[model samples]
Target: MFKKEITAGAKSKVKSSVQRGIRTKVVETYPLLAPHIDEIIPKKSQLDLLKLPDRVSLYALNNEPLFWQHMDDAIVPHLRVVHQFPHCFSRIGIDRGAIRFVLSGAALMVPGLTSAGGQLPEPEGQLKEGDVAVIMAEGKEEACMVGQLKMGTEDMKEKKKGVAIDGGHCLGDGLWKMSID
Candidate 1:
Protein backbone atom coordinates (compact mmCIF):
# COMPACT_ATOMS: atom_id res chain seq x y z
CA MET A 1 0.00 0.00 0.00
CA PHE A 2 1.25 3.47 -0.83
CA LYS A 3 1.15 6.04 1.91
CA LYS A 4 0.48 9.66 1.00
CA GLU A 5 0.35 12.83 3.01
CA ILE A 6 -2.91 14.77 2.99
CA THR A 7 -3.06 18.46 3.82
CA ALA A 8 -5.03 19.56 6.87
CA GLY A 9 -7.65 21.34 4.76
CA ALA A 10 -8.24 18.29 2.63
CA LYS A 11 -8.42 16.11 5.68
CA SER A 12 -11.06 18.36 7.16
CA LYS A 13 -13.19 18.15 4.05
CA VAL A 14 -12.91 14.40 3.94
CA LYS A 15 -13.88 14.18 7.57
CA SER A 16 -16.85 16.46 7.04
CA SER A 17 -18.15 14.40 4.16
CA VAL A 18 -17.77 11.10 5.99
CA GLN A 19 -19.41 12.48 9.08
CA ARG A 20 -22.35 13.65 7.02
CA GLY A 21 -22.68 10.44 5.04
CA ILE A 22 -22.03 12.54 1.97
CA ARG A 23 -19.62 11.87 -0.83
CA THR A 24 -16.80 14.26 -1.56
CA LYS A 25 -15.66 15.08 -5.07
CA VAL A 26 -12.08 14.18 -5.84
CA VAL A 27 -10.14 17.09 -7.21
CA GLU A 28 -8.35 16.01 -10.37
CA THR A 29 -5.86 18.82 -9.96
CA TYR A 30 -4.12 16.86 -7.25
CA PRO A 31 -0.94 15.26 -8.53
CA LEU A 32 -1.29 12.05 -6.54
CA LEU A 33 -4.78 10.99 -7.67
CA ALA A 34 -4.58 10.62 -11.46
CA PRO A 35 -3.45 7.00 -11.59
CA HIS A 36 -5.79 5.24 -9.19
CA ILE A 37 -9.26 6.00 -10.43
CA ASP A 38 -10.13 2.47 -11.43
CA GLU A 39 -8.79 1.01 -8.21
CA ILE A 40 -10.75 3.48 -6.11
CA ILE A 41 -13.86 2.93 -8.13
CA PRO A 42 -15.03 -0.61 -8.82
CA LYS A 43 -18.73 -0.04 -9.24
CA LYS A 44 -20.90 2.00 -11.60
CA SER A 45 -23.02 3.40 -8.82
CA GLN A 46 -19.95 5.08 -7.43
CA LEU A 47 -19.03 6.71 -10.69
CA ASP A 48 -21.13 9.82 -10.29
CA LEU A 49 -19.49 10.51 -6.97
CA LEU A 50 -16.17 10.69 -8.78
CA LYS A 51 -17.07 13.87 -10.63
CA LEU A 52 -14.07 15.68 -9.23
CA PRO A 53 -11.53 13.38 -10.88
CA ASP A 54 -9.89 12.56 -7.58
CA ARG A 55 -10.39 9.33 -5.67
CA VAL A 56 -12.88 9.56 -2.84
CA SER A 57 -13.90 7.16 -0.09
CA LEU A 58 -16.86 7.19 2.21
CA TYR A 59 -16.60 9.81 4.95
CA ALA A 60 -19.63 9.32 7.23
CA LEU A 61 -23.06 7.86 8.06
CA ASN A 62 -26.46 9.29 8.99
CA ASN A 63 -28.48 6.21 9.81
CA GLU A 64 -28.13 3.38 12.25
CA PRO A 65 -25.44 1.28 10.66
CA LEU A 66 -25.39 -2.50 10.84
CA PHE A 67 -22.27 -4.63 10.77
CA TRP A 68 -21.66 -8.33 11.20
CA GLN A 69 -21.77 -8.96 14.92
CA HIS A 70 -19.40 -11.96 14.86
CA MET A 71 -17.21 -11.58 11.79
CA ASP A 72 -13.76 -11.61 13.38
CA ASP A 73 -13.25 -15.43 13.48
CA ALA A 74 -14.02 -16.41 9.89
CA ILE A 75 -10.54 -15.67 8.52
CA VAL A 76 -8.67 -18.58 7.02
CA PRO A 77 -5.84 -19.28 4.58
CA HIS A 78 -6.52 -19.95 0.88
CA LEU A 79 -10.22 -19.99 1.66
CA ARG A 80 -12.53 -19.97 -1.35
CA VAL A 81 -14.96 -17.08 -1.57
CA VAL A 82 -18.52 -17.63 -2.71
CA HIS A 83 -20.60 -14.60 -3.61
CA GLN A 84 -24.03 -13.87 -2.20
CA PHE A 85 -24.94 -10.26 -3.01
CA PRO A 86 -25.67 -7.90 -5.91
CA HIS A 87 -22.73 -5.67 -5.13
CA CYS A 88 -19.01 -6.33 -5.37
CA PHE A 89 -16.96 -6.55 -2.19
CA SER A 90 -13.78 -8.15 -0.94
CA ARG A 91 -12.46 -10.39 1.77
CA ILE A 92 -8.90 -9.20 2.21
CA GLY A 93 -6.27 -10.95 4.28
CA ILE A 94 -4.43 -8.31 6.28
CA ASP A 95 -0.97 -9.81 6.58
CA ARG A 96 -0.50 -10.63 2.90
CA GLY A 97 -2.70 -8.05 1.19
CA ALA A 98 -4.39 -10.89 -0.65
CA ILE A 99 -7.75 -9.78 -1.94
CA ARG A 100 -10.68 -12.00 -2.84
CA PHE A 101 -13.30 -10.44 -5.06
CA VAL A 102 -16.93 -11.46 -5.01
CA LEU A 103 -20.08 -10.59 -6.87
CA SER A 104 -23.47 -10.95 -5.22
CA GLY A 105 -24.64 -14.44 -4.15
CA ALA A 106 -21.18 -15.89 -3.76
CA ALA A 107 -20.29 -18.03 -0.81
CA LEU A 108 -18.45 -16.74 2.25
CA MET A 109 -15.69 -14.20 1.49
CA VAL A 110 -12.47 -16.13 1.12
CA PRO A 111 -9.03 -15.92 -0.48
CA GLY A 112 -7.59 -17.38 -3.68
CA LEU A 113 -4.04 -17.32 -5.02
CA THR A 114 -2.98 -14.98 -7.80
CA SER A 115 0.21 -13.82 -9.53
CA ALA A 116 -0.53 -10.11 -9.31
CA GLY A 117 1.33 -9.82 -6.06
CA GLY A 118 -1.74 -8.93 -4.02
CA GLN A 119 -4.32 -8.20 -6.67
CA LEU A 120 -6.78 -10.87 -7.71
CA PRO A 121 -6.14 -12.09 -11.25
CA GLU A 122 -9.80 -12.72 -11.85
CA PRO A 123 -12.78 -11.77 -9.75
CA GLU A 124 -14.34 -14.75 -8.01
CA GLY A 125 -17.26 -15.20 -5.64
CA GLN A 126 -20.47 -13.50 -6.72
CA LEU A 127 -21.80 -10.91 -4.26
CA LYS A 128 -25.16 -11.37 -2.56
CA GLU A 129 -27.08 -10.31 0.51
CA GLY A 130 -26.06 -11.25 4.03
CA ASP A 131 -22.50 -11.68 2.89
CA VAL A 132 -19.76 -10.59 5.25
CA ALA A 133 -16.51 -9.15 3.87
CA VAL A 134 -13.31 -8.27 5.63
CA ILE A 135 -10.83 -5.80 4.14
CA MET A 136 -7.34 -5.16 5.38
CA ALA A 137 -4.37 -3.23 4.09
CA GLU A 138 -0.85 -4.38 3.32
CA GLY A 139 1.54 -5.09 6.20
CA LYS A 140 -1.43 -5.23 8.52
CA GLU A 141 -2.72 -8.21 10.48
CA GLU A 142 -5.86 -8.64 12.54
CA ALA A 143 -8.85 -7.02 10.90
CA CYS A 144 -11.18 -4.39 12.19
CA MET A 145 -13.48 -2.20 10.10
CA VAL A 146 -10.98 0.35 8.88
CA GLY A 147 -11.52 2.24 5.66
CA GLN A 148 -10.78 5.84 4.62
CA LEU A 149 -14.53 6.35 4.63
CA LYS A 150 -15.69 8.25 7.69
CA MET A 151 -18.26 10.77 8.84
CA GLY A 152 -17.84 14.37 9.94
CA THR A 153 -17.53 15.30 13.59
CA GLU A 154 -20.28 17.88 13.16
CA ASP A 155 -22.74 15.24 11.99
CA MET A 156 -21.70 13.02 14.85
CA LYS A 157 -22.27 15.87 17.24
CA GLU A 158 -25.74 16.43 15.89
CA LYS A 159 -26.50 12.73 16.09
CA LYS A 160 -25.40 12.73 19.68
CA LYS A 161 -28.02 15.31 20.49
CA GLY A 162 -30.63 13.03 18.97
CA VAL A 163 -29.76 10.16 21.27
CA ALA A 164 -31.92 11.57 24.00
CA ILE A 165 -34.83 11.52 21.56
CA ASP A 166 -34.25 7.83 20.77
CA GLY A 167 -32.93 8.27 17.23
CA GLY A 168 -29.21 7.62 17.29
CA HIS A 169 -27.15 4.46 16.97
CA CYS A 170 -24.49 3.17 19.31
CA LEU A 171 -21.04 4.60 18.66
CA GLY A 172 -19.18 2.13 20.84
CA ASP A 173 -19.47 -1.54 21.66
CA GLY A 174 -20.99 -2.90 24.88
CA LEU A 175 -24.17 -1.29 26.11
CA TRP A 176 -25.66 0.75 23.30
CA LYS A 177 -25.23 3.85 25.37
CA MET A 178 -22.78 5.96 23.42
CA SER A 179 -23.77 7.76 20.24
CA ILE A 180 -21.50 8.97 17.45
CA ASP A 181 -22.58 12.55 17.74
Candidate 2:
Protein backbone atom coordinates (compact mmCIF):
# COMPACT_ATOMS: atom_id res chain seq x y z
CA MET A 1 0.00 0.00 0.00
CA PHE A 2 2.95 2.27 0.56
CA LYS A 3 3.68 3.99 -2.74
CA LYS A 4 5.64 6.94 -1.41
CA GLU A 5 8.51 6.97 1.04
CA ILE A 6 6.59 7.46 4.27
CA THR A 7 8.35 8.05 7.56
CA ALA A 8 7.47 5.83 10.50
CA GLY A 9 7.29 7.72 13.79
CA ALA A 10 6.30 7.28 17.42
CA LYS A 11 7.26 3.68 17.90
CA SER A 12 6.11 2.06 21.14
CA LYS A 13 7.76 -0.94 22.71
CA VAL A 14 5.53 -3.95 22.56
CA LYS A 15 4.70 -5.61 25.85
CA SER A 16 6.21 -9.03 26.47
CA SER A 17 2.80 -10.67 26.41
CA VAL A 18 1.90 -9.01 23.11
CA GLN A 19 5.27 -9.85 21.67
CA ARG A 20 4.65 -13.46 22.58
CA GLY A 21 1.29 -13.26 20.89
CA ILE A 22 2.88 -11.86 17.72
CA ARG A 23 5.45 -14.65 17.82
CA THR A 24 2.70 -17.20 18.18
CA LYS A 25 0.78 -15.78 15.23
CA VAL A 26 3.88 -15.72 13.05
CA VAL A 27 4.82 -19.28 13.91
CA GLU A 28 1.26 -20.44 13.35
CA THR A 29 1.22 -18.78 9.95
CA TYR A 30 4.58 -20.13 8.85
CA PRO A 31 5.10 -23.47 10.54
CA LEU A 32 8.62 -23.80 9.15
CA LEU A 33 9.67 -20.81 11.24
CA ALA A 34 8.56 -22.41 14.50
CA PRO A 35 12.02 -23.71 15.29
CA HIS A 36 13.62 -20.31 14.73
CA ILE A 37 11.24 -18.23 16.81
CA ASP A 38 13.65 -17.72 19.66
CA GLU A 39 16.42 -16.61 17.34
CA ILE A 40 14.11 -14.34 15.36
CA ILE A 41 12.59 -12.71 18.43
CA PRO A 42 14.59 -13.35 21.54
CA LYS A 43 12.87 -12.77 24.85
CA LYS A 44 15.38 -10.12 25.90
CA SER A 45 15.31 -8.23 22.63
CA GLN A 46 13.20 -5.12 22.49
CA LEU A 47 10.36 -5.31 19.97
CA ASP A 48 8.75 -2.08 18.90
CA LEU A 49 5.55 -1.43 16.95
CA LEU A 50 5.35 1.46 14.53
CA LYS A 51 2.13 2.60 12.93
CA LEU A 52 2.38 3.74 9.35
CA PRO A 53 -0.02 5.49 7.02
CA ASP A 54 -2.96 3.52 5.53
CA ARG A 55 -3.34 1.40 8.63
CA VAL A 56 -0.14 -0.57 8.31
CA SER A 57 1.71 -1.87 11.38
CA LEU A 58 5.42 -2.56 11.45
CA TYR A 59 7.35 -4.63 13.96
CA ALA A 60 11.05 -4.09 14.29
CA LEU A 61 14.08 -4.99 16.36
CA ASN A 62 16.33 -2.04 16.94
CA ASN A 63 16.31 -0.24 13.56
CA GLU A 64 15.76 -3.32 11.42
CA PRO A 65 12.27 -4.00 10.18
CA LEU A 66 11.10 -7.58 10.60
CA PHE A 67 7.47 -7.77 9.53
CA TRP A 68 4.37 -5.71 8.76
CA GLN A 69 0.64 -6.07 8.44
CA HIS A 70 -1.95 -4.06 6.53
CA MET A 71 -4.96 -3.51 8.70
CA ASP A 72 -5.99 -6.96 10.05
CA ASP A 73 -4.37 -8.83 7.17
CA ALA A 74 -1.72 -11.51 7.52
CA ILE A 75 1.71 -10.34 8.62
CA VAL A 76 4.17 -10.16 5.71
CA PRO A 77 7.92 -10.36 6.24
CA HIS A 78 10.17 -7.73 4.81
CA LEU A 79 12.28 -8.77 1.82
CA ARG A 80 15.39 -8.30 3.92
CA VAL A 81 13.88 -10.41 6.68
CA VAL A 82 12.70 -13.08 4.24
CA HIS A 83 16.13 -13.17 2.62
CA GLN A 84 17.48 -14.54 5.88
CA PHE A 85 15.31 -17.66 5.42
CA PRO A 86 14.52 -17.92 1.74
CA HIS A 87 13.05 -21.38 1.72
CA CYS A 88 10.58 -20.85 4.54
CA PHE A 89 7.70 -19.65 2.40
CA SER A 90 5.85 -20.88 -0.67
CA ARG A 91 6.85 -19.15 -3.94
CA ILE A 92 5.47 -18.18 -7.34
CA GLY A 93 7.57 -16.98 -10.23
CA ILE A 94 6.48 -14.31 -12.66
CA ASP A 95 7.81 -13.62 -16.14
CA ARG A 96 10.57 -11.12 -16.75
CA GLY A 97 8.11 -8.88 -18.59
CA ALA A 98 6.04 -8.34 -15.47
CA ILE A 99 8.91 -7.39 -13.21
CA ARG A 100 8.71 -3.66 -13.87
CA PHE A 101 4.98 -3.49 -13.30
CA VAL A 102 5.23 -5.48 -10.08
CA LEU A 103 7.99 -3.22 -8.81
CA SER A 104 5.73 -0.28 -9.57
CA GLY A 105 3.15 -1.70 -7.12
CA ALA A 106 0.62 -3.02 -9.61
CA ALA A 107 -1.69 -5.90 -8.83
CA LEU A 108 -0.30 -9.12 -10.34
CA MET A 109 -2.39 -10.37 -13.23
CA VAL A 110 -2.92 -14.08 -13.95
CA PRO A 111 -1.51 -13.93 -17.49
CA GLY A 112 1.91 -12.94 -16.34
CA LEU A 113 2.02 -15.73 -13.79
CA THR A 114 0.42 -18.40 -15.96
CA SER A 115 2.55 -17.80 -19.01
CA ALA A 116 5.42 -20.10 -19.93
CA GLY A 117 7.85 -17.90 -18.03
CA GLY A 118 6.01 -18.39 -14.76
CA GLN A 119 6.23 -21.18 -12.22
CA LEU A 120 3.62 -22.46 -9.83
CA PRO A 121 3.45 -25.08 -7.11
CA GLU A 122 3.02 -28.67 -8.15
CA PRO A 123 -0.54 -29.92 -8.16
CA GLU A 124 -0.08 -32.03 -5.05
CA GLY A 125 1.53 -29.25 -3.02
CA GLN A 126 -0.45 -27.81 -0.14
CA LEU A 127 -0.33 -24.21 -1.39
CA LYS A 128 -3.85 -22.89 -1.32
CA GLU A 129 -5.77 -19.70 -1.93
CA GLY A 130 -5.12 -16.92 0.62
CA ASP A 131 -1.67 -18.30 1.58
CA VAL A 132 1.21 -15.86 1.83
CA ALA A 133 3.47 -16.16 -1.22
CA VAL A 134 6.88 -14.92 -2.16
CA ILE A 135 6.87 -13.53 -5.69
CA MET A 136 10.03 -14.27 -7.58
CA ALA A 137 10.92 -12.80 -10.92
CA GLU A 138 12.23 -15.04 -13.68
CA GLY A 139 15.98 -15.64 -13.32
CA LYS A 140 16.17 -13.66 -10.08
CA GLU A 141 17.96 -15.02 -7.05
CA GLU A 142 15.96 -12.97 -4.56
CA ALA A 143 12.22 -12.59 -4.09
CA CYS A 144 10.79 -9.37 -5.55
CA MET A 145 7.48 -9.22 -3.72
CA VAL A 146 5.55 -10.62 -0.79
CA GLY A 147 1.81 -11.10 -1.22
CA GLN A 148 -1.24 -13.25 -0.54
CA LEU A 149 -2.65 -15.34 -3.37
CA LYS A 150 -6.07 -14.38 -4.69
CA MET A 151 -6.53 -17.78 -6.31
CA GLY A 152 -5.20 -21.29 -5.79
CA THR A 153 -2.73 -22.92 -8.19
CA GLU A 154 -5.37 -25.13 -9.73
CA ASP A 155 -7.74 -22.27 -10.28
CA MET A 156 -5.04 -20.07 -11.78
CA LYS A 157 -4.25 -22.87 -14.20
CA GLU A 158 -7.85 -23.05 -15.34
CA LYS A 159 -8.72 -19.38 -15.50
CA LYS A 160 -5.57 -17.64 -16.65
CA LYS A 161 -6.37 -13.98 -17.19
CA GLY A 162 -7.40 -12.02 -14.14
CA VAL A 163 -5.86 -10.65 -10.99
CA ALA A 164 -4.03 -13.45 -9.24
CA ILE A 165 -2.55 -11.64 -6.30
CA ASP A 166 -3.71 -8.59 -4.43
CA GLY A 167 -1.71 -5.66 -2.99
CA GLY A 168 1.90 -6.72 -2.46
CA HIS A 169 5.06 -5.32 -0.93
CA CYS A 170 7.58 -4.84 -3.70
CA LEU A 171 11.25 -3.95 -3.97
CA GLY A 172 10.93 -0.15 -4.11
CA ASP A 173 7.61 0.41 -2.41
CA GLY A 174 7.33 2.75 0.53
CA LEU A 175 7.32 -0.16 2.93
CA TRP A 176 10.63 -1.37 1.55
CA LYS A 177 12.14 2.09 1.61
CA MET A 178 10.67 3.16 4.96
CA SER A 179 13.10 3.72 7.81
CA ILE A 180 12.13 1.99 11.04
CA ASP A 181 14.43 4.16 13.13
Q: Give the TM-scores of the predictions, in the order they appear.
A: 0.21, 0.95
Residue 168 displacement in candidate 2 (angstroms): 1.0
Cα lDDT, all candidates: 0.23, 0.87
lDDT, candidate 1, residue 152? Answer: 24
Off by over 4 Å in 1: 10-90, 94-112, 115-141, 144-181
lDDT score of residue 97 within candidate 1: 36
lDDT string for model 1 (35-143, tens) is: 4423333223221111011232212122112111112221111111111111233433222432221111112122221212322212343322222333333454433
Model 2, residue 35: distance off in Å is 2.3
Error of 1 at 25 (Å): 16
Per candidate, the number of residue pairs that clash is: 39, 0
Model 2 misplacement above 4 A: none
